[model samples]
Target: MSVSNEPTLKPERPFFSSGPTAKFPGWSLDKLKTESLGRSHRSKIGKARLKYAIDLSRELLGVPDDYLVGILPASDTGALECAMWTMLGPQPATVAAWESFGNVWIQDAVKQLKLKNLTALDADYGEIPDLASIPQDNDVVFTWNGTTSGARIPNTDWLESGRSGVTINDATSAIFAQEMDWPKLDATTYSWQKVMGSEAQHGMLILSPKAIERIESYDPDWPLPKLFRLKKGGKINQGIFEGATINTPSLLATEDYIAALEWAKSIGGRQAMFERANENARILEAWIEATPWISNMVSDPAKRTNTGVCMVFGGDWYESLSDEDKAGVPKKIVSMLEERGVGYDFNGYRDAPPSLRIWCGGTVDAEDVKRLLPWIEWAFEEVKASHAN
Candidate 1:
């Protein structure tokens, strides 16, 4: 059947960027707790707010009582770096990467920190590496979900229960949307901007007791940047995990995050977010299965991510294009969809092969995602028609 160039209905809320994603259903400026703003983060009220964010994050994510959650700088990248630069030296390490952000960690291990006893296993955009092949005896670093590639580890069973090494995960896009085996993750990092749909550029670091021990016991030979330092006088600095940050923080962003967390609580916390994300992705997955010209970037449904759902062109129209033309097809589709006001910022990562990545995180409504699918088909048909002439 020929798809209409114009979709009858557009997404009610056309805000689906993977990061800094769609806000909670009832979000507004007044929802933020503004009392903490315009005050020094070191003040009693400010520290209390920060501590509250930490505590609430723990409550919602179901982090263990022993685990320490801290607000860090530079979004997820900063949080992961603080964990890496502090704990990675003097241990045989394994880094598994399949997407854009994970590759950055591989570069840090090889070129920056220059770990001699490191094993780096990586795959193409939509594929995952052999998780079973990774030696659990060594320090393991990987992303829980590949936001750009839309591939995620199906479960944490592969991580050894009794392991000598620590497990560090960059779970930026997966934390609230997926089930996290917290006990298995010695060090995990995430940002509020992804699933929670809060403002961007802030990160949360969750550290297990084992991770703290690693910090206290081992010290890197090279001098750590001030922002990366998590220790003081050969002891793990407890204050950092408390409200006392190494640098000043944006209290406004913290307020925004707090509002999002409160909204999360009102809506039944982590499980609610997980269910919404699952339903949103399921809606898109159904559309992909029924549509002739569109297909998921990640083939295996179990391994595919429920948050950032990446898709690529398929069928005769896409297959017939030249290599250069095929590279631009997804971009054209995204641009046309945006022009029609049906979707925005749904383009795939620059480094990944041409595709579209829709944010199907909890903050996005299932109905909006369903509405966006027809618009995607309309955009594709419009692009194909233009190219033919």
Candidate 2:
């Protein structure tokens, strides 16, 4: 525990990247079903496997009976783009962003889509956007959880129950770990690489009847890409929701997602995953509270996320360092931790303020988090000592 010495105890499972996060507990490649691997995606077995994966998602996430849940190419970003490009132009649009991924949505709305009547609501890092201020009857776009900032919307109660506009939410980091008001959400997107801890490249998109109506009724003046085309002959393509993907998909990744979903079901479904993530986050947040030199970047418990908990230097000595030196402290601590084999990829997002982001998603073991804390404290102490001298 000395400042100059590394912690003897290290986390056994410390692969904590925010996305493509640690896999489900007891996960192994050999556990995946191989029957669907080499078959044509359109064939009977391939379609059956894909449909089964979608069915599992619908059941575990508690999607509405009428909602269409399907897999999309290009991970969460592409899925969000599919929703935004197809459904946004019919009404006045509004986009809210507080972190990196959310900002990408804003840019797409303003710079890419070129929506004439658009309202962009933004908040500083470590803060949540004001959802209460969203204009009524405007197609709203936002992320349920700000992955980079470690801030998340506390609830969806602010969304008008009877609003006319479609609400497109990037729930890439919020899916299984958060309780979403499914009825109020129109077009919601998440990634397998996130909460499910599955392979990357594929994203899940959920669409309500309202969102479907938007796609079926409105056509943007801009030319639609083949992948973004949700409508065929001015009617919603029901096939896509039924395991018909726009492009070829990785069957291996599909099996991996199916395995993760099965594991979730085995462990008491979404509630258990939520609890696991909450407990993991609580461990790290509690450490921040007890440790004098560091603090949660989000500051407020209500606004903070249960995944990707961001940390900031809060000690008096850290405050006294030059801005340049202060910026390097987190990197130094992260590098130290990596070198010690206690953690990896815990550094903050490139665009985010110099900080560390520890993934505490459902897949991350709570015991690993508890063991990782002392090592983090040790790293911070060593970094602070180096800066002090």
As a whole number from 0 to 100, the lDDT of residue 135 in candidate 2 is 76
lDDT (Cα, 0-100) at 3 in candidate 1: 45
lDDT of 1 by residue, 1-389 (tens): 34464678888899999988998988899888888888999999999998898889989999999998898899999999888888997789998999999999999999998998999999998899999988878998999999899999988878988788899999999999998998899999999899999888889899999999999998888789998888889887788888898899999889889999998899999999999999999999999899887789998888999999999888887899998999888888788778778889999899888889999999999999989887877777877887887
Candidate 2, after superposition: displacement of residue 61 in Å?
A: 0.2
> Total clashing residue pairs per candidate?
0, 0
Task: Return the TM-score for candidate 2, rounded to 2 decimals.
Answer: 0.97
Model 2 has an lDDT value of 0.89
Question: Compared with the true structure, what per-residue lDDT tens digits does model 2 show for residues 71-160?
Answer: 899999999999999888878989999999899999998898999999999998899877888877988999999999999998877788
What lDDT would candidate 1 get against the real structure?
A: 0.90
TM-score per candidate, chains pooled:
0.97, 0.97
Off by over 4 Å in 2: none
